[model samples]
Target chain A: SQQGEEDPQALSIQEGENATMNCSYKTSINNLQWYRQNSGRGLVHLILIRSNEREKHSGRLRVTLDTSKKSSSLLITASRAADTASYFCATAAATDSWGKLQFGAGTQVVVTP
Target chain B: EPEVTQTPSHQVTQMGQEVILRCVPISNHLYFYWYRQILGQKVEFLVSFYNNEISEKSEIFDDQFSVERPDGSNFTLKIRSTKLEDSAMYFCASKWETQYFGPGTRLLVL
Candidate 1:
């Protein structure tokens, strides 16, 4: 089964608008993490929400996790052109090695000025 | 702040040749991981290392692949014989609580 699957494969928004992307997973997880990648670059760790936590915030990023539903969402508030990048949700399974992450098909966000 | 780092930003090798990708994880990090992304696909986990041994590996990691932490800070992935399908960006990561990824090494196997 796919571990992480995100909704809305692509998104385009104007500056100052909000961008929300949803993700679902198939198994129990210790933590869910969000990552950002610019074109042709490595992924940058954004935020991590543990199964015990419902929601988390960091700067302009807000992440919510619903373990009961096996789902998570990432909301980028006040989007900016610089926010154009691919966002991915990765899960660290409770049964697996702690750092092994299974990533989802990312949300391609295009924040136009 | 400190971060993971990798060598050979890009590598082009012929199929069947051996290629070794190197990474220097965060000095204090104890867990290290290797992942790869084929151009348009999701990032896939290849293997994880801790205490100088492999903790776990994915199916994608076969006999053709091997990993080592020969020294204290250097971790490496060696593909015994490259294949066309091996072309992708290989990323090395280190874990504290949050994983820190290094700028990936893009490999092109022709």
Candidate 2:
């Protein structure tokens, strides 16, 4: 089965700094998505990058996809205290039409004020 | 912007008892999905529904678990017999090109 594994399980940084996390998957995917979950709360959709796309950006969030390496990275620039959350990378397989997402363990990000 | 909604923000049930979790996906979305996250664990996919039928389910969705879309607006997940391990935060998602998730229901099987 295809699985996404994120590196640096936990990260802590001061506000205004940049935080980057990497995710590596096992199989081909149609698109990769990034989601944020506040402590014990629901997930919020952040961004989605397609397999054909190399990079994309949304406000302060920047995402890069390298299908060749079966990996992706998410960069949060100028992080704020409110950005403290668990960041997850989920993948939608190329063959799955139902749009099932395989989620990674996630990177726990703590943005200190 | 429309968002998915779930009922019973929190539920506490005894082991072996049955419990049903309800969700109302985005009004115009065609595909729906259910996922759960154990405390401090990764979120896992449970099942996906489309056109009023289950399109895909993960191994975690066993015979004891079932889903229904009885009314046009509501989608539900029923656990016939809950176990201690069944405790988790259940989330519902509606898909367009991208998926929008609900606030989630926290189920505690004690």
Cα lDDT, model 2, residue B16: 99
Per model, the share of native interface contacts recovered reads: 0.81, 0.97
The DockQ values of the predictions, listed in order, are 0.86, 0.95
Q: Estimate each model's TM-score.
A: 0.98, 0.98
Q: Write the per-residue lDDT of candidate 2 for residues A1-113, one digit (tens) a residue.
A: 89889988999999999999999999889999999999999999999999999999999999999999999999999999999999999999999999899999999999999
Give candidate 1's error at residue A65 in angstroms. 0.6
What is the clash count for each candidate, in the order shown? 0, 0
Cα lDDT tens digits for candidate 1, A1-113: 54799998999999999999999999999899999999999899999999999999999999999999999999999999999999999999888765699999999999999
Residue-by-residue lDDT tens digits, candidate 1, B18-108:
9999999999999999999999999999999999999999899999999999878899999999999999999999998888899999999
Best by DockQ: 2
lDDT value, residue A47 of candidate 1: 97
Q: Report the Cα lDDT for residue A29, model 2.
A: 96
